[model samples]
Target: MAAKRILIVDDDADIREATQICLEITGEWEVLMAEDGVEGLAIAQLEKPDAILLDMMLPGMDGLTILKKLREQVETQTIPIVILTATAQPNERKNFDQLKVAAVITKPYDPMTISDQIMSVLLTSR
Candidate 1:
């Protein structure tokens, strides 16, 4: 099978680079990245990646807005989205759950297990 493609949308260059390095080292998937929501949305539409890892807080547009827009479009509606956020409040979690996001990953994530965690979500989703 072809390696799964993941589009990672984050405003932080360091986070993006770290995620890319971690995911690539596993050799199980291909990674694409965008610095902001606008670019992220464009890449998503053009690439149609298998999954999206979107940062909840962004400069151009916030993650919730991006999620809403993606859900509205037919091409992107079915793609799984994992929200990456630094906020881990219960209310935020509840809201994200209501939005039907695939998962919420807190920032300062475990580099060693991030790929495995994502893969687990994908497998179970199937």
Candidate 2:
């Protein structure tokens, strides 16, 4: 199988870099990073990565907004989306669940296990 491609949309530089490195080392997946929702939306349509790791909060558009936009578009409608968030409060997780997101991964995640966590989501989704 081809190496899986992962698009990460987050405003935090450190988080992006750390996640990128972790995914590369563990899964050897091709990874792309976007600073905000606009760039993320464009990249998601253009690159059509195997999966998306989207941050919950962004400058112009939030993750839920981006998710709605992507789900509205035919090109991105079926791609699996895993929300990366700092806080997974009960109500917020419930809200994201209603959005039909794959999962809401809280921040300060274990880098070593990040790929497995995401891959599990994808594999089970299939």
Deviation (Å) of 90 in candidate 1:
2.8
Give candidates' CA RMSD values in order: 1.2, 1.2
Candidate 1 per-residue C-alpha lDDT over 64-104 given as tens digits, one digit per residue, 9 for 90 to 100: 89988888888898888999988868887887777678888
Q: Report every candidate's CA lDDT.
A: 0.88, 0.90
Query: lDDT per residue, candidate 2, 1-126, as tens digits?
Result: 678999999999998999999999999989999999999999999999999999988999988789999898999988899998888788877877776788778887897898999999998888
Best by lDDT: 2
Instruction: Give every collision pair in model 2.
Output: none
Give the lDDT of residue 114 in candidate 2: 88
